[model samples]
Target: MANHDTETTEKLEKFGKRLKELRKAKGYENYEQFAFKNNISRSQYGRYEKGQDIRFSSICKVLKALDVTFEEFFKGFD
Candidate 1:
């Protein structure tokens, strides 16, 4: 159980890193600006970037806002 928890934490952190990477690539240096522009909850998006859990539908919205397909967003993740 401990190992599983660790693995989950690692995955979440990686996901957050990927999100930040994409956001920066899209020319938004500030997460707040990105969230505000996309009509997402800025605090929630900040939590997401800090590796907090997120809902599937919310992630889909984020992906759409980032102009990335599911496949593209998950490309390098395992």
Candidate 2:
């Protein structure tokens, strides 16, 4: 059970990092540019990608900004 939880947490961290990288790879320069491109506030979006526990409402908004469904973000997880 602990192992499963650890794996899920690790996967979330990886996803968060991947999102940050994608912003860079997409040539957005920084969070400010990325958020601006997606019409989100930079500081707030930073909190979204920080991989910390956040409200579902904020999560949904962030997912919308990322242009991904929950299934897409969570992929192989059940």
Judged by lDDT against the true structure, how good is candidate 2?
A: 0.68
Displacement of the residue 51 alpha carbon in candidate 2, Å: 2.1
Stretches of model 2 off by over 4 angstroms after superposition:
1-12, 22-27
For residues 1-78, could you state the per-residue lDDT of candidate 1 as single tens digits?
A: 133487898988898899999999999999999999999999999988887898899999999999999999899788
- Could you say which candidate leads in lDDT? 1
lDDT (Cα, tens digit) per residue for candidate 2, span 1-78: 133477677766676676686567567777888788877777777765665445678667767776777887667554
Show model 1 residue runs off by greater than 4 Å.
1-4
Predicted structure 1, TM vs. truth:
0.92
Best by TM-score: 1
